[model samples]
Target chain A: MARYATTPSQTVGPYLHIGLPWPDGPFAVAEGTPEGVWIRGVLYDGAGAPVPDGLIETWQADPEGRFDHPDDPRGAVARPGFRAFGRCPTDANGEYGIFTLKPGPVPGPGGTLQAPHIDVSVFARGMLHRTVTRVYFPEEAAANAADPVLSSVPEPERATLVARPAEDGYRFDIRLQGEDETVFFDV
Target chain B: MSTDPTTRPAPPAYARDAEVHPPLDYPGYRSTALRHPKRGLRLLPHLLTEVTGPLLGEDRISENDSDLTRQHDGEPQGQRIIVHGQVRDGDGRPVPHTLVEIWQANAGGRYRHTGDNWPCPLDPNFSGVGRTLTDDQGRYRFTTIRPGAYPWRNHDNAWRPAHIHFSLFGRAFTQRLVTQMYFPGDPLFFQDPMWNSIPDEKARERLVARFDYANTAPEWALAYEWDIVLRGREATVFEDEVDED
Candidate 1:
């Protein structure tokens, strides 16, 4: 049998806005959805400078811990206004934002529970490939402590994964390099 | 019934053949030095989120979105070409009804973006962007002008090869891919960091599109074909991993 290898990834490049962005891409849930919160942050490089040409995408479950995808073993959940996905391009200041509701705890390996979190993928002009990361809620202390994925990360670096409370929702800045860099994933 | 958690195996994780992909910190690509993460990436289990993604299609795009040449009232300045291909998974199964988007420079090696202030003249009739949903057989086709090579400040007189940027959305988030499709036998490959970044020669070759004489429209336009393959899931059953994760 013939086997095909997966194609490699490349950077989104400087002019991604021409093709990638949708008018309503920042909204994971429909606009004006009750209790919807915004996840906003800036993408910084090792020099501590903002990356204006970057793009960020997010995926997460609904508050009920259910996904609208067919692959979910619990079966797919069809929510009227929940898309469960968000994509946003950075502004001139290199800041990106996504509006979504808090995700519920998800099942983890070994029957453990993962902390309520959002999966994130970052792309930019200079990057050869997108980098993967996760965003956990700051208030989920107990759940975060028991989470298998969170526990695997080194203590100091774990805090970088947790988002800080913001006025409208939560603020979780992503630093591609330098001190206090976010913990990226290899999923 | 078996209640042991161990009895339920984990779902197959996306294959991580590091050598097949470019390193995040390749210095040859000057921009990577300060932008690539310093710490190692932690392993993430393929839970529900990894195996599923948003299904984008018909609602977001239009009929003329696949034809870049006709988007504007007048024709763009360049050699008209038809680029087509099939979207498949690593297992070689066709991925139908998925979204594929592309953007590129004009014939003069200049982008339509405000940030692209290169000295080359911009085509007033070209936006250089197009998109479409794959057909039942995972096939997608586009009508556009062939782009030209452009100079960059990456190194002394750095010029990128003529290429089109591609973005694909497969069945799962893990299967998402973004890559550049280059013209076959371009002289710029040796000096371009982006082209040489891939460690595997065979993997690098996949990025080049092949000229198809059969697909060419006589007296109308030239044709090129390039197939894309996204990552495949592990061979494990969903039932085992759902409970374990």
Candidate 2:
């Protein structure tokens, strides 16, 4: 019944790009896949500066709220091309893009149904440990209202986690510090 | 830095001295304190899934992906060395076929990054990047030069110990871990704040790699062995139910 404590985190450093980003690592599913839409955003630092060396990773369930993972009690994902996971590194301008489908709904704490949201983890220089947050779709206004995690945040601060819809996907900008800083969750 | 044990907060894990981890009062670690906001917040299931990772294939690997001793042509300039290690879970079980990537500064104490403006010559042949997969026994090895210590702007005359960044993948995406490995007799151990961040001196020592004399080829290269332990299985019985089909 003993638990092993994982090693503590340290700064991702200015040189993370050399080791973390592999060819097409940003694409969890092969880019240009038909069903999923792209999730795009810019990662910013405390001074409101763009974080060029940052890495953003996300995980989500399929449209039916099911995951292809072994941990998902609901069972395996039905779709072949959908990986439900993506890792994108920021460009010089601090922009990152991931092509994936919009997740539907999943179960929240207890019995409530959670809204469609992608778990986001931001890792960058000066960040000893990754800051955890979430990206919810504004289009899912109904589900977002009843969501447990979303309700936990103050009403004014909840908007930071909702992504604005673009032509094909959603736009969710992440701010590490300063005003309108993204709400980080303890995980 | 007077740390009042009476005022010190702990969930028991981080009760150690934070003053030693220099860049005293680092903003990056501010939110990790005992009284931080996120400490009491409950996490949802979406935040807990540990599945889905890049299933990297050996097809894309070049002839010398694991060899840092030589890149384009000629050998790198430095003391030649070999690093060998295994990836394991807390229960002492091998984590097989996981992707393990390592990056470090060149022998001249310069990283092959645009951010490094340090006045050091770059070795054209050494990019200082190496990637490999753990074998069935959870073992991996790489051949590279011993990285040199580099100065940082943390404090007065602050210098970081020579270290390599390692990324190890577990069965799922959430299980991925990133940590640094240091050489056993590095003089920087006492000075580097990051290495001393762990309150427990014993846990901090785990990060240091042991020198393996037998594996070192008489004069060709020195060998260092480091084993990494990751978060172990939690509620694994329920996890097995999903695969019963």
lDDT string, candidate 1, A88-181, tens digits: 9999999999999999987777678888999999999888988999999999999999988889899999999999999999999999998899
lDDT of 2 by residue, B1-245 (tens): 22432222211111111122222125323322211222223343333243443444464366677889867688889989999988887545777877788899999889998889889888887899988888898899999999999987766677889998887766655455667888988888787767765566777777789999989978689999988876555443323344222
- Highest DockQ against the true fold, candidate: 1
Candidate 1 i-RMS: 2.8
For model 2, how does the per-residue alpha-carbon lDDT over A44-154 read when each residue is reduced to its tens digit? 776677878888888777787767654554445656676666788899999998888788777654456778888877777666556668899988898899987898888
Cα error of candidate 2 at position A164, Å? 1.2
Give the per-residue Cα lDDT of candidate 1 at B27.
Answer: 89
Please compute DockQ, using alpha carbons, for every candidate against the native two-chain complex: 0.59, 0.29
| Estimated TM-score for each candidate | 0.95, 0.83
TM-score of chain B of 1: 0.91
Steric overlap count per candidate = 2, 1
Displacement of residue B135 (Cα, Å) in model 1 is: 1.5
Model 1, position B103: C-alpha lDDT score = 97
